[model samples]
Target: MIRTATPADVPVIHAMVRELAEYEKALDEARATEEQLREALFGERPAAFAHIAETEDGEPVGFALWFLNFSTWRGVHGIYLEDLYVRPDRRGGGHGKALLTELARICVERGYERLEWSVLDWNEPSIAFYRSLGALPQDEWTVFRLTDGALGALGAPTR
Candidate 1:
């Protein structure tokens, strides 16, 4: 069963995040602390939300963390999935697909124009799974980011 995550789930979410990072070969970069996650998810003004998938007996298996984005061209809001992970041992049992299905349902219900996420170029298994869901890749788009010192410098006052 899939349900919206609560404050009580922060630790589990944080752990799964680390597990995901490990799977992606970037565990060293998983810097989010439990307090940070709790604040982000349950703060007075939340910036994002998450859903957890649990076994029938109530064991957590996976999660989908996402936020809403505005598209000027479409003039509508869309769901931007930041992370989606299913435990390695629990994969192949439809948990991943089920999580996505729930996200799709949220989009349709809220009149969102699109649901999107990025997968590593080398993640063939994930790519195949997304394709099986009829998700198309935005080949024309290239993702760029500014972070740490670069991000700070860009936002600094002109001298």
Candidate 2:
């Protein structure tokens, strides 16, 4: 079963995030803390949301973390899935699909226009899995970001 995450699931979610980063060979970049996740997910003005996938016996096996993004062209809000992970041992049990299905349900129910996310170029397994879900690659678009020092510099006053 898939259900909305509560405050109590923060620690497990953090662990899974680190585990996922490790699997992606970028564990060092998974710098988020449980406090940060808790604040972003459950704060008075929440900026993100998450859902947990649990076994019939109520044990958590995976999670999906996401946030709303607005598409200017569509003039509607869509879900940008930041991370969707199922433990290595728990994979192939439909948990990953269940998590995504829940997000799709949320989109349809709320009138959201899109469900989007990024996949590592080299992660063939994940690429295939997402493809199986009817998610197509936006190959023409390149993703860019400014972070940490670069972001600070850009926001700083001109000399």
Candidate with best lDDT: 2
What's model 1's lDDT at 102? Answer: 96
Clashing pairs in 2: none
Clash count in backbone of candidate 1: 0
lDDT of 2 by residue, 1-159 (tens): 999999999999999999999999999999999999999999999999999999999999999999999999999999999999999999999999999999999999999999999999999999999999999999999999999999999999997
Q: CA lDDT of each candidate?
A: 0.96, 0.97
> What is the TM-score of each predicted model, taking all chains together?
0.98, 0.97
User: Alpha-carbon error at 103 in model 1, in Å?
Assistant: 0.7
